[model samples]
Target: MTMEANELRVSESVPVDTGQRRGTRPMAPDDVAAVGRLFNRIFRRHDQASDDDLGRYLQTVFFGSPHYSPELGSVVHENGANGIDSAILSVPMAFMVNGRPTMARLLCAFMADGKAGAVGAARLARTMRAARQDMCFSDNASPVSADHWVAGGGIVLPIQSLEWQRSFLPLTAAAILAGRHFPIARSRVLVGVLRPIDRALRRLRPSMRPKTEGECRSEAARVEEFLQCASAMLERFAIRPAWSPAEFDWLVRVASMNRNLGTLQCRKVVLPDGRTIGAFLYFGKQDAAATVLNLVFEEGRERDVAAAMFAQLDAEGYAVAVGMAQPFLMNAISRQRWLSFRHRGYFCMVTRHADLKEAAERNDIYIGGLASETWSRLLTDF
Candidate 1:
């Protein structure tokens, strides 16, 4: 059979003599539309997106990629009627494991219709685990999904699951947080009322004020510069993304497309000697909280780079800054009393390799940012 024919055959439901149909199969390109519809119904109900838009996003993220692998493709659960009821997306990635190239998969957008039940979700999860990959992981699993993952023998990274935030304008940040539930809190009049109080609070607390030390400086960072800094800084870890220049560039471009998070900002921190020590990527708008996508720095210069990044955000008038609690930056983050942390989502992994599991447990692997699915527009855009 031709490759296309064979793929269709595999993705189609198989019937036994008893007339029972198979439950799961490898996801095909044709399944994108149905999967997109299911995703919109489950996760994007508040702001439903068009099937065409979702299909384009899924194609770009899952099918149209330099790292796409047939052997480790995504999986979907099929109902008795041969309709897609659940989907577990797997984005294939290349990684360097102690200097050797290995294949990894980032699981994202695991969605199921109510008809699928827990059994269908579990079946799809099993299909994903059966794929040929060194490791399978996710940092965006919901609480319900996390429970299923742990039940299925996955381990959760506690520290990595927390999100840390530093409020430069505490009252303004509080108002914004409240706005999520009560729209009135987001009114300009209320924000205007809180501005003076936040300013006074910043004056009273030295830690709350943005660091203006001139020891390090930040400038707009290009993808090439970010790749260079990230490659060097991540070498300390035993397992890291082994993206080529082209692949790394593609990843950054895709990440920059998520405008829902806000405008993408890429900056590099340097010293007077023109030496680049760190680079940070985030999305922000004036007078709003910025969501940091990735922050990488030289081994001993975390504090310096972090301070510079915060100062840059303050200058841009962001009310607050937040990001994943990367293990390497915990000390620097703890030193700042103004920063607070809360449980965001579970970071879970399923791997049979002892070394990989050990590295993850020890927090010695690069698991977030480009290594995970947070960059996908599926999570940000409806």
Candidate 2:
């Protein structure tokens, strides 16, 4: 039942050193649970997340409608034990430039099963050899086992740009925005925390009477007003395409995922004018002092609407607020109270390649595009 030399076709599409002893075997569907558990132990343990939530997250990323490819993934075990000790998952993405096609492997995740089998040096070497030619990658905030990745010969470098981390507890969005040295060009909209608001609403529900029908109508009108403002902004510049409800739903779901990981919460921002112009997803623990998340606005409305929204959130008492700031969003996040979050908050370990690095840098700007070699192992069985 052993893999024979003839059957083991060394993938030439990518360059990797196969001299290492352990070889990659494609992950099987049955291996998904074990893979999930491994990830849960490494990343979700501290979050105190329920098994159901973790399972749901895994299902969405791995078993949902669009299943990840097991062929591009592998589970590395010292010997042929059915239970996986380590795993690597990857997906191929074609980036077109100047009418030319460039193929890159998006590493999903890599995980080791609590050091049970203890990933061997040979396993790492072989996997790296296998992935080298294909431009294998990993993300900055991945929960992958870093030790194994380094053993596999992957070097951590400033691929694409970098992952920046900001602590909402220590500062306010106003401070970050106001920092003169912060990259105004890169700044975007501010996402404010609604933690206090959500908790207060719940606590005061019994004592506080519900708003009257007229008041309810007026509130609904505000949501519509914001929506109108957002729509108008989109029409003016035509920068970002109009957002569909489906996209908002996806945003909401992603927000929930973040909440499980940390203290962030998300809410759709409704303006007094009766429109839902934008959404702010908060990140931070409720018990913590601040919340930080992204505020996405309809492209052209960044200046007028997003600004007003942040001001409102600030007045409402939610602390630390921050937003993605690229040149387009500079005007919104650049302010006296907003402090600039430091860059290099996250990093990706990738095979050294000039062109691939450039693509990764651009992908860093968007959600779900960061490539990390650790992703390969974590998502193999997905």
Candidate 3:
């Protein structure tokens, strides 16, 4: 069957709520246009995308995925005017828990229109959490959304929510950080003025330089090669994604499409004998901050992997390197004086299974990177 026809059949299977003008229902292919409008109204008000563009994105991310599950599909709230005012985008994922295959729902890009849809939004969130999936979680939640998740019996993971940064050029990094809030700081003239100061500061603090003395070296890797390295690195974790080769390829391809973040770079750290010990992925650009997407290493190889990754970023002229702080890498990050940590958002999860909940609370399970919603273009693209 054609993709559109398959989607329509999936939508028809879901029972519609016709009793009320304002109610939540399973999001269908037909709802993409309205959901796109609602998304722009809430998250992209200043720079709204054309309906056609948004429709294509929604289709690719939600409907086109091989993992899409109708029972755990996205949800939309209908207003009195038969229009959508609230939405919660969900991407179904397969995971391995204690050697058993489990399904999960990764929530992303939630939105509600002003006061009119506030309650509806909350209800929609609750609806998603209450789905039949083994677990539901999000790593890109705002403080408001975090509170809602907590209120709905979800646990807020303190460790997974923190972000770490290592600055190679302090002055330039500061300006780029400030640019997020002030446009003037991002001006070419201001950036040009800071560049020289950053050069002097780097020379003044030789001890702060990222260490590159490890015997391991990073080699550019294809997505499939990274997956092989990742599989070896993540086997120790009790609960982790169990994506098929095709699903993983699709995920990485979608992640690479976020041009706003810069070019996607993937590399595998290997020993002198060519044994792969680690792998890292990130978006990098010259004179700008590089955002790490996933960084995994074998036990006790954190320092080697981290050193190689940062050395490469520094050599590429990135002013700073940042990513979600994984608990296992905390010691390596702390040893570097140039690296710092900051709380960004809450990584919250909801699950009835006690083992899964405890494992997550103790930081035994992996939660960020491919497991989270950071790969979505909706976050970085207009």
C-alpha RMSD for every candidate: 4.0, 11.8, 4.3
lDDT winner between candidates 2 and 3 = 3
How many pairs collide in each candidate, listed in order? 0, 67, 0
Question: What does candidate 3's lDDT look like per residue over 18-44, in tens digits?
Answer: 654456767889888778878877887
**Predicted candidate 2 versus true structure: per-residue lDDT over 48-165, tens digit per residue:** 3336555565545443312134434443443333345566544444333222333444455555555564543235335553235434544443324344455554544332223222
Order of the predicted models by lDDT, top scorer first: 3, 1, 2
**Model 1, residue pairs in steric clash:** none
Give me the displacement of residue 202 in model 3, in angstroms: 1.8
Select the stronger candidate by lDDT from 1 and 2: 1
Candidate 1's residue-wise lDDT over 1-382, tens digit each? 0012233234444555656556777788988878887787888764254567778878777775686756566777776665777878777778887777777778877887776545667666665442223677788788887887677666789988988988889889889767756869968899989988888887787678777445899999866777788888989998888888867777777777787667777899999999999999888866877888788889899999988888888888888888889888888777765788988789887765678778878889876777776667776556
**Global Cα lDDT for candidate 3:** 0.77
Give the range where candidate 1 is weakest over 10 consecutive residues by summed lDDT: 1-10
Best by TM-score: 3
* lDDT of each candidate versus the true structure: 0.76, 0.40, 0.77
Candidate topping lDDT: 3
